[model samples]
Target: MKKNYFFSIVALLTVSLGSMQGQVVNGTFENIKDNGLISNWGMNFFTPITIDAETGETTQDFITFGCWPGFVFPSWDANHGQHAMQMTNGLNVTTNTIIPAKSILFNDPKQDIPGWNPGIPVDLSDQVAMLGFDYKFTRMGNDIAEAELVVFGTDGQELGRATVDISQTNTQYQYLYEPVQFTSFGIPASIQVSFSMAKEGSVPAFGSTLIVDDVIVSYAALANDEFQSTQFIVYPTVASSEINIVKGSTAPSGNYNFTITNMEGKTVSNQSIQLSDNNPFTVDVSQLSKGIYFISSKGFSTKFMKQ
Candidate 1:
C-alpha cells in the first residue's frame, strides 16, 4: 500500500508532531508557521532554506513537480474559519512515486509506528457520541479518500471508531456526522483523527483533492432507541436500477421521510413516502452514477452501492 511506503521512507527522516487535550489543536489549520506550513502537524519531507549573510534575505526551495512544501497544506478556501487543510495525491519528487497526502493527530513521542507518531493524547472524561467535520472532495477518477476517528483506552486497546468514505466528487462543502460505537468500557487515553486524499490499494490519481475543516466532537449521546424503534435495511448492498427499503416488524406504518446522499456527503434525493404494513418501499436509483451512497431518515441510516 502507498501508506506503507510513506512510513518506510519517513523512518529515515525526522519530523515534529502536535499535541492537545479535550479537543483537536489547529483543527481549522489557522495557526501556520513562517515557513507556510500548518503548525503542529508533521511533514514527510523538508526543503532547506538558506539565508544571505549580508542581505539577510531568505530563500526557500520547492519541488518542481508537486505543490510546495508537501501534499497537505493550508488553504484560504475554508468552510468556517480562516483556513482549512487541503490534501492531494501528487508525485513525491524525492522518491519519484505517487503517494496520498494525509494529516494525522499525533502527540506522544514515546509511541511510534515504526517511524511515525500517529495519534495525540485525549482526555475523554466526558464521553463523546459523534465526530463530525465539513469537507469538499474532488475525486479525479477511481481514487477514494477517507476520514477516520479512533478512540483508544489507557492500555492502548481499541475502544471505538468511526469512518467516512469519500468516493464521490463534491465541489461544495458538506457535513458528515458519524457515531462512534465502543467495543469495551475503559477510559479513553488518546484519539486519532486523519484525512487522506487517497487510500491504500487505490489507483493514485493526480488532481484528486480533499479540503477539510472544523473537526468537532459531539458530547450529546445518541439515543439508545434512536433507530431501533423504526429499524430498516437496504437490500442488494450492490444495486443497479432500484433498491428496496425494508422496515422492521416493529416499525409503524405511515409517511416517512427519506434522504439519499452520495459518498461525498452530497444529498442526491429526498422525499416522503407512505409505507404500508409488511411492504417494502422501492426507490429508483438507476439515475445515480456508479458509486457508494447512503440512505438515511429521521433516526436510521445505511449504505448501498449503485452499479
Candidate 2:
C-alpha cells in the first residue's frame, strides 16, 4: 500500500500540527466564565496546555470554537454600561480557515512564556499616536469586517499599523479612528489588537457580524493640522474662572496653535496665538480643573464650560 499510505499521512499531519500550539487569550473580551465566553478571545483555536507528569505543573484550557460568537454582550449589545464584543462569520468544519477572530490586550495572554512575550506591553514612547475603537458592523453578502492595530518596537520591529474595514452595513455604533504613522526610529514596545469578522477570500454567506466597543489607546494628534484656525468664540458660557477668546474674521491670519481640551480628551491648555486684526484672545482656565473645555484651534472647535 503506497508505503503504508505514506506513514499514515505522516502520522496524521503530526497529530494535527501538534495539537494547535496553545496560549494567547483575553483582551478585554473580559474572560467571562461563559454566558457568552470571551476569555482572551479566539476563533482559530489553540489554547490547551496541561502538563504535570511528576511535579511539573501546567494548566490552561478553552479553545474549540470554530468561529462566530465572540460573545460578551450584556448592556443590550453594549456601548455604555455592561460590556460589548461580538464577531460572527461562522464555519470551521475542517479548515478553509474561516476562523482567526483574535483579541489580546496584554498583561499576559500567554505564549511561549519564559522571558516575557504576549503583547500588552505598551510604551509608545511619548506623544502617543493613534489607535481608537468603538464599532458596529453587519454586512451579509458582501461580507467584510476588519479592525486591527499593530505596534511593536522593543526590537521586534514593526512599529505601527492601524486598519479599519467594514463593508458598510452599520446600524449604530461607529467611531473607528486609526492613525499611527511611525518612523521616529523606535519606541513603541508592544501592542497587538484584533477585531475581525472573518474575511480573506471566499465564504460570505453566514451572519457576517462585528461589534466591538471602547478600546481607546490614546494620543491623537492631527485634528486637522495645517492651520485653518478660523472661527473663534468663548465667553462666559459659564466659567467660575476665566476664559475669553473672540476672534472672528475667519480667524487664522498668522500665528496659531492653541489647544485646551478636557472632556476626557485631556490637553488641559495650550497656547501660541497672535491673530493680527487687533486683539481679542485670552485664556487662563483660571486654575483649570473644573469641567468641560475644548478650544482646539485651526479647523475650529467649540464647547466651553468650567463651573
Candidate 3:
C-alpha cells in the first residue's frame, strides 16, 4: 500500500506541472489580436493613426511645428481640423486608432528621422507575471536605439525602471521577462511602459521611424514554478546614497546570494546574507556611480537607479 501511495503522488505532481506549463504566456504588443487581452495601447504625435492590416505598420497623419512636435503640444496643427491632430506620434495627440507604416516608409524620399514615444500602463497588483514585445529599427542609419519599461505608482511616482538596447541588424524579435511582485510598488494604481527612437541630442526627423508590435502581459500559472517567490521591498526607491530592503513578507528564509550588476552585465557587488524573518538590510550605494543597476536575488531580479 505504501508503494502505491508513492506512485499516486508522482502522478498528481506530473499533472500539476503540465497545467502550469500551459499557463505561462508571452505579454508583448504584437497586435491586438495577438495579445490575449489588451489593457491599453496608443501612438504618439500624429492624429488618426492608420494600421496596415497586412504589414502591421503604424503611421501618423498630421505634422508638427517643432522638434518634439509629435503630440507634445496641443496648439500646433498638421491640419486645420480640431480632431485632425492625432496622437500617433506626439504627446498632445493622444488617440485610440491603428497606426500604419506604409504611409511613412523609412526610406521614403520625404522620410527624415521621426521620433516616437509609445507606452502602456496596467494595474498588475492582481497579477504577478509580465512580458513585453520587442521593438526594432531594421533599416536606419543609426544602429543604436533605446527602449524602456517604467513602473509608476498611482501618485505618479516612478517605482522602477528597465532599459534595453537593440541592434539594427536583428531580424528576430526579442522578449523581456519581468518576474516581479506587485506589492513592491506599494499599491498598484498606475503603471506606464514606453518605447522611442531618435538621436541623442536632436529631435527625431519626420522620416526616421521604428516598428513596434506584439505586447503581451499575463499572470504566470503555478505550474511553471518560475513565479517569483522572493518578495523584495526597497524603501525610498529613489535613493541617492543608501537604501533599505524591506523583507517583511517576500523575504526568503535561509541563505541567499545577492548580486548587483550594471546594464553591461558587469557585476559591481555580490554577497551572501542570512536573512532573518522580515528583517531589513541596508546597502550603501553612495560610492557607486549614478546609473541603472539590476538587483538580483536567486533567479529573480529588478532594476533600480542611483541618483
Q: How would you encode candidate 1's per-residue C-alpha lDDT over 1-307 as one tens digit per residue?
A: 1111111233111113444433355665777665566655543543445566666666553333244445767789986557887777656455456666777655533322212556667655545545766688877768888888888889999989988777877786766757778888888887777776666667677677888876655422211112222467667666789988877677777788999999666899998977777688899999999765778776666566676
By TM-score, highest first, what's the ranking?
A: 1, 3, 2
**Candidate 2, which segments miss by more than 4 Å at Cα?**
1-90, 93-126, 139-170, 176-186, 189-191, 197-206, 211-217, 225-307
Off by over 4 Å in 3: 1-40, 43-165, 168-230, 248-251
| Full-model lDDT for every candidate | 0.65, 0.51, 0.39
Candidate 1 vs candidate 2: the TM-score winner is: 1
Candidate 2 per-residue C-alpha lDDT over 14-36 given as tens digits, one digit per residue, 9 for 90 to 100: 00001111111222233443334
Task: Kindly list the per-residue Cα lDDT of model 3 for residues 67-150, writing each as its tens digit.
Answer: 333321121221111211111222223442222221110111111212232222344433424433333344344434444545
Worst 10 residues of 2 by lDDT: 9-18
Could you tell me which residue pairs clash in candidate 2?
Answer: 25-40, 26-40, 229-298
Report how far residue 151 has shifted in candidate 2, in Å: 5.5
Give the Å shift of residue 197 in candidate 1: 1.9
Instruction: Go through the candidates in order and give the C-alpha RMSD of each one to the true structure.
Output: 12.4, 17.0, 21.3
Best by TM-score: 1
Tell me which of candidates 2 and 3 scores higher on lDDT.
Answer: 2
> TM-score for each prediction?
0.57, 0.26, 0.35
